[model samples]
Target: MVSKKQRLASVDALRGFDMFWIIGGEALFLPLFALTGWSVFHFGHGQMQHTQWHGFSFYDLIFPLFIFLSGVTLGLANKSLRGLPVSDRAPVYRKAVKRLFLLILLGVVYNHGWGSGIPADLGEVRYASVLARIGFAWFFAAMIVWHCTLRTQSVIAVTILLGYWLLQTLFGNLTPEGSVNAWVDQHVLPGITYQNRAYDPEGVLSTIPAIANALGGVFAGRWLAHHSGDHKAILKGLFMAATVSLLAGFLWHWVYPVNKELWTSSFVLITCGCCLLLLGIFYLVVDVWHWKRFTYIFSVIGCNAILVYLGTSLVNWQYSSKSLFGGIAAALPQQAAGTFLIACGVILLQWLVLRFLYKRGIFISP
Candidate 1:
C-alpha cells in the first residue's frame, strides 16, 4: 500500500499546482504577456480569460480539473470509510455533507456576501461559478461513493454522462435560433428561466455533466487506492484513463462540442483525461522519483488553499504595496512598476498566511 506520506505529498503537490494559476496567473502572467507587446485580446491568452458565450480555453479547464481532483480525494476518503465499522460510516458521511455545504456557502459568500460590497442582485452575482459547481459536484459524488461499491459507482458515472447527452440532444427546447446549450439551459435549471438574451455562467443544465467529471475522478481514486504501492499498476491505470477519456471526449465532441461552459460529457472526458495525465506526471516524479523539495512551496499553498483564496479575495493586499512600495516604484517612474510591486506584496502576504497556517498545523479542506 502507498504510505500516508506518499499520498499526502501527491495530493498537496497537485493541489498546489492547481492554485498557482489562480494566485499568479491573472495578476502576473497575463500582464507579463501584455508587457511583451502581446495584445490582451489578440491571441489565445485572451481566449484563455473566458469565451464570450461558448467555447473553451486553458483557463476554463482549471475549475473542472480541480473538481475532478476533489472526486479523486472523495474516492480515497470513501475507501477509508469503508474499512471502518458500520457505526462509524454515518458520522463520516455527515462530515462529508457538512464540508460540501460549507464549500457551497463559501462560494456564494465569496461572490455575493455583503462583505465583498458587491450588489446583492442575484442576476449580477456570480451564483453559478466554478467553486459552487465543485461544491455541488463534490457533494453528489460523495453521496454516490459513500453508498455504492466501486463497480456500482462506475455504472452510475457512465449512466449520468450518457443520460445527460440524450436529454440535451433529444428533449431540449429549441432556442429562438435553435441552439443546444441555450435550449438545455432554459429547460433544465430551476429557480431561473433560461433566456437567449444572456448567458448564465452557473446555468442549471451544466451541473449534470459536471458531476460526471467528478465521477471520473472517483474512478481514478478507487483504482489508485486499490493498486496502492504498485507503480506499474498505477501508471497503467492512468494511461487507460487518459486514453479512454480522450477518445470518448473526441467522439462526443463531434455532436456536442467540447465546451467548458456546457460542461458537456465530451468536455468532462477531455478535461479529466488532461487531469489524469497531469496527475500521472506528478505521481511519477514526486511519488516514484521522490523529487520532494521543489514541491514544498506549492504544498504550503495547497495545504491551506481555501484560506489563501479567501484571504486574497477579502483583504486588499495591494494597499500594502501602494502604501509601502508604491512610493519607491513611483520614484523610478516605471509605469508597470507599481503593478508589479503590488503583485509582489500580494504574493508575499499569501505566502506568509500559508506559512503561518502550516506552522500551526491548521489545514483547511473543502
Candidate 2:
C-alpha cells in the first residue's frame, strides 16, 4: 500500500508532461514538419497551437490541466489539515490565501508588469493572466473542499457550472468582440484588457467556470485519498468517472460549445474528463505497473514545475541557448534543422536547471 504521505509519481509525471509543452515541447514537432513536409507532423504542429477564437486544440488543454493538477495537489496536501483541530486550520487557510496572492503577484510579474519596469500607470498593466486564473480557481476550489463534504462539493461544482452557463448565455456570445468575458474585462476589470483587446483570455468572468474545473480535480483527489490502498479500484473508478464526464461534455457541447477563450462550461467538463482520463492512464502505467524509466525526465521537471515556469520568464534562455548551441544550429543543413536545434537547446537548458533543483531536493511550491 502506498503511504498517504507519499507523493504520487503519476501526478508529477503528468504535470511535467503538461509543462513540457509550455516550455517549448510544442515546437519540438514543428521542425519535423518543416523537414519532412508530412501531414502527420503538420497536424501535430497545429495541435500544439491554440485555436484562434473558438474550438479546441491540444494546446488549450495545457492551462486547465495545470490548474486541475494544482487542485489535486491542494486536495492531497490538505488531507492532514482536514483532520486537524478547528483552531489549527487557521494556518492552512492563511497559507492558502498567501499562495493565492503570491501567485497573483507572480502572474503580474510574469506578464512583464514589474519585470519589464514599472508601468506608466495602473491601466498599462494587464492584470488578467494565466497564473492569476489558476490562483483564483485553485483558491475558490480549495475553499470549497475545506468546508464542504464530497456531496456538497459535487453539488457546488454543478451549481457553478450551470450558473456560469446561464450567465454566458444571457450576456455573452462566442466572438472575441461579443464575448461576455471581453465585455467584463473591458468595463469592469482593473488594468488594461489583455493586448488591449475587447477580452482577455484569462479574464474575470470566465474564471467562474474554471473554478468548477479545479473542483473536479478536488473530487478526483478526495477519491484517490479515500481509496489509496486499492489501485485496481482506483483505476476502475477513474475510468468510469471519466467516461461519464466525457459523455456529458460532448452532449453539452452541442449547446455550449467547447470554447477555450471563454472557458465555456463544456470546455471545463471536456478538459476535466481528459485530465481524469490521463491521470488514470498514467496511474495504470507508472504507479500500478511500475514502468518508471521513461517518465523520469517528466517527473524531474514536475518536481520543480513552478520554478521552471517562472525561470522561463525571468531568465534569458534564448540567449543562453544561442550562446551554447548557436554553432550546432548554424552547422545544421537546413534552416528548419537549425530552428529545431535551438528550440531543443532552450528546452534542454531549462530541463538541466530543473534537474539540478530536483536532485538537490529543492522544490518551489506556489
Candidate 3:
C-alpha cells in the first residue's frame, strides 16, 4: 500500500520515457547502425518512423501514449474534483481551460506565430497540431470525470468510439487525401493544414475517438486510484484491463483498421492496451520492486516534461552540437554513425539542462 503523499514514480517515468523519444529519441536509432553495421536494422528504423499512410508504427504510439498519461495524471491529481461543489469547481475548470488555451497558443506559435490558424498569401497556417490534440482530449476527458461517475464515463467512452466507427463506415472513406476526415478539414479548416495535405491527420472529426483514448486512460487512472495502496490489486487490474482492450482492439481492427491518421477506434483500444502494459511494467520495476535507479534519468525528464518539450524547440541543440561534431560526422565510416554523434551531443545537452533543473528540484507543471 502506498501513502497519500507518495507520488507514483511509474507515471513520471513513463511520461519522461515518452518525452525522451519525442525530442531526439529517433536520432539515436539512426546512429546505432554505426555500431552493429546491420543494414537490416534499417527495417527497425522504419518502424520508428511513422507508417506513412494506412498502418500503425512505433512513432504513432508516442503522441497517444502521452495523451493517455495526461488522463492518468488528471485522474490521479484531480480525484478531489469528483466531490467538489459546483461553484467551487469553477476555478479548477478555469485552470483546465487556461491550459487548453495556452497549449493552443503555443501550438500556433510553434506552427507560425501570430499569423497561424489563418490563410496566408503563400503557405496556409496549420491550426491543427500535436499539442492541440492533447489539449482537446484532456479538456473533454477532464470534464467527463468532473461530472460523471466512473461507470457513466465508461459509457460515454464507448458511445464515442461506436459513434465514430459508424460515422466513418457509413460515410468516411478512411483514406489519406480523399477520406471523410479530409472532407471535414477542407470544409472546416479550408487551406489551413500540415504541409498542404488534403486533410489534417489531427483534424476535427477524428477528435471524437481521440477523446475515447484519453477516457480509456481515465478508466485506467480511476482503477489505479481505486486500488491505491493495494499493489497486488493494482497490478492484477491493470493486466486484466489491458488484455481485454488488446483483444478488443485487434478484433475491431479487422473492420475499422487501426489507423493513427484517422484515430480509428481500434487504434485507440490497441494504443491504450499498450499504454496499460507499459504502466504495468514501470510500476512493477520502479514502484513495486523499488528499482528507482533504473528510471532516475527518465524521471528527471518526466518531472519537467513541459520544460524540455518547449525548450528543445528553442534550444537548437542540434545546430550547436554540429559546431563541434561536424568533423566527427565527416570522419565517420557511415553517415548514420556521424548522425549518431551529433544526436548524442544534442541529447546530452538537453539532458544536462534537465539534470541541472532536476538537481535544483525545479519542476514545471501545468
List residue ranges in candidate 2 displaced over 4 A: 1-6, 77-86, 114-120
Which stretch of 10 consecutive residues in model 2 shows the poorest summed lDDT? 114-123
- Name the top TM-score candidate: 2
The per-prediction tally of clashing pairs is 1, 0, 2
Per-residue C-alpha lDDT of model 2 across residues 184-238, encoded as one tens digit per residue = 8888898876677888888889988899889888778767777887998899888
Against the true structure, whose lDDT is highest?
2
**What is candidate 1's lDDT per residue for 129-160, written digit by digit as tens?**
55677878887887787677878888988898
lDDT of 2: 0.84
Model 3 ranges off by over 4 Å: 1-6, 78-86, 114-123, 327-336
Worst-scoring 10-residue span by lDDT in model 1 = 190-199
- Candidate 1 residue spans exceeding 4 A from truth: 1-6, 34-44, 78-87, 114-127, 173-199, 331-334
Q: Which pairs clash in the backbone of model 2? A: none
Cα lDDT listed for each candidate: 0.71, 0.84, 0.81
Of 1 and 2, the candidate ahead on lDDT is 2
TM-score of each: 0.83, 0.94, 0.91
Model 3 TM-score (2 dp): 0.91
